[model samples]
Target: MGYGITLQVSGDYALFTRPEMKGERVSYDVMTPSAARGILEAILWKPAIKWIVDRITVLNRIDFESIRRNEVGSKIPPRNVTAAMGGAHVDLHQYPSEDRQQRASLVLRNVAYLIDAHFEMNPSKVGETDTPEKFYNMFLRRARQGQCFHNPYLGCREFAARFQLIDHTEQRLASHYADIEEMDLGWMLWDIEYGEERGKGKTMYSFQPKFYRTMMRNGVIEVSREVGL
Candidate 1:
């Protein structure tokens, strides 16, 4: 799964506009120490800016079964499917774990779907031939740069309080973070309540890449990167 960030700037911030997001506020979620340094330099950002994540949106939820089904009777040869399972079993742990590149390729194809869902890009262009490819490529390039947004809001699920118009389907995002310190580069942290008797522990953190792998395994996100990994 993927998440998005929106910032409500105070004194000074990495104030910029995402062209793709239609002039919405852009706050880069620094994934690495180097990228963090870059942001510090680019915006002359200081720790004193009262910098806090404004909001985060988990972008995609991939699953394995959906992917398997899409390939049921496709005309093209399945690039990664080694053995066809006839209503058998699907286990994601059986796949490679270390190479995020391979997993990224698979996850990015459906990124356009998430982008469309969140940004609401014109759907009329999906069949324009170059449109889908361009949309896919744009997100791929951004992720490769280790770029992401940090949301300071309570979490994706509770963020609707700030929205004037809310769509339940869009609320599919799992709230990952409760506060600002949980912010990390490209890593979206939110809160989740499991049972009526909420368990107690040092709150767990869920990584997006891993979530994406799960999604790929579950078939929520349809794109697959089987070759370059």
Candidate 2:
């Protein structure tokens, strides 16, 4: 059996950008499995351990709000930066006034979730000193002490998230959707399967996006290896 931990995360605003909407930003009804894993990794992560999200519990009612914000239209080309670093003159600076564009976003407000997750030893990264129990204890210590490599955010970096450990023996806090029996979330982005590089020092890597049909029953989304996109 794998060791697991429960983290209670809450944020003021969240934008889980929907892939279909290219122009404007739209958020999913709930947190995706990948986002849950990200939060756990932020709290405590090591190359030897890979986080697996077991389930997510929605603790707040889904509320959406729209707002307009200025964003950059495009990013600076990497080639231009590389050339400039090599003493080749290239215009790499992008003035916000010229690139700024206003866009509306439909985002979730006052969101909270309880993420249940576990860690598995990465076969390639594991060493003689690495053990599941050792990493598990380290995660617990860091989480309880409010320590992290970086502050975890809710979908977007601008929206900060706060997290705490949940005790299993204690009664779980009630969810706003407790009265609702169930709901279908349609097809949602599951996670990106990153293609591994075969040779050393090779810059060949592929990112394949995956999706899954999500159904929430009594405010919980269960994730298992058997459930595939």
Candidate 3:
């Protein structure tokens, strides 16, 4: 375990698209662990350190709303992009007009969550000067000053999130459904696990998503980092 921190995130809308659902987007009942990790990385991230979500606390009532959104159906191929970068003549652009489609999505509305997470140092990537405290302080400073590499979003880029670092020494806010004894949330996305290097320099890896059974007790979901298929 490394240094840990808590973040209070809120947004008007969030769309954590389910992996099984295609064409139409349907969000999960609550924020996903992967999304929470993304939010933390948006604030401060380094190759030497990796973020981990311990748990998440629902601060608002779970609610959903339906909306149709315009999205591009096709993306430029990676080969085309690489060829263009190498000065080869290649079509490396997406024609939104040709691929635009409106898809119905069920998304969360007026969402708020408290993310409890920590980061662990990657030995191979860590530098001589890199220390756990250094990264921890860096995250704290960036978070306190409202600085991020990019705008931290809830589940999607459009749904920008507002974040506040919960100073561990200060009083914490209460969960909205604290009165409830328990609630079953079923399976939820944890994060992605990448396979070992497929080539020299370890430049390429395979992507695989992991999910875990989740149960929310008193609006708080305790995540077991151990997740699998």
Ordered by lDDT, highest first, the candidates read: 3, 2, 1
**lDDT, candidate 2, 1-229, per-residue tens:** 4798889999999988889999999999999888888889888879998888988889999999999989999999988997998899899889999899999999999999999888888999999988888999999899999999999988988888999998788678877777778889988888999987767755677998888888888888877655455
Instruction: Work out the TM-score per prediction.
Output: 0.17, 0.91, 0.93
Which ranges in model 2 have alpha carbons more than 4 Å from their true place?
A: 81-92, 197-202, 226-228
State in Å the error of residue 203, model 3: 6.4
Q: Which order, best to worst by TM-score?
A: 3, 2, 1
Candidate 3: stretches off by over 4 Å: 82-87, 199-204
lDDT of every model, 2 decimals: 0.25, 0.88, 0.91
- List the lowest-lDDT window of 10 residues for candidate 2: 220-229
lDDT of 2: 0.88
Report the C-alpha lDDT of model 3 over 110-184, residue by residue, as the tens digit.
Answer: 999999999999999999999999999999999999999999997889999999999989887889889999998
Candidate 1 C-alpha lDDT tens digits along 1-229: 2222221111111211112342222322311112222222222222222112222233332121111111111222342243343343434243223322211101111111111121223444334353434543443454445333432111111111111122233454332232223322322212121433324843344422211111211212222222111
Candidate 2 local Cα displacement, residue 43, angstroms: 0.7
Q: Name the better of 1 and 2 by TM-score.
A: 2
Question: Which wins on TM-score, candidate 1 or candidate 3?
Answer: 3
On lDDT, the candidate that comes out on top is: 3
lDDT of 1: 0.25
Give the higher-TM-score candidate: 2 or 3: 3
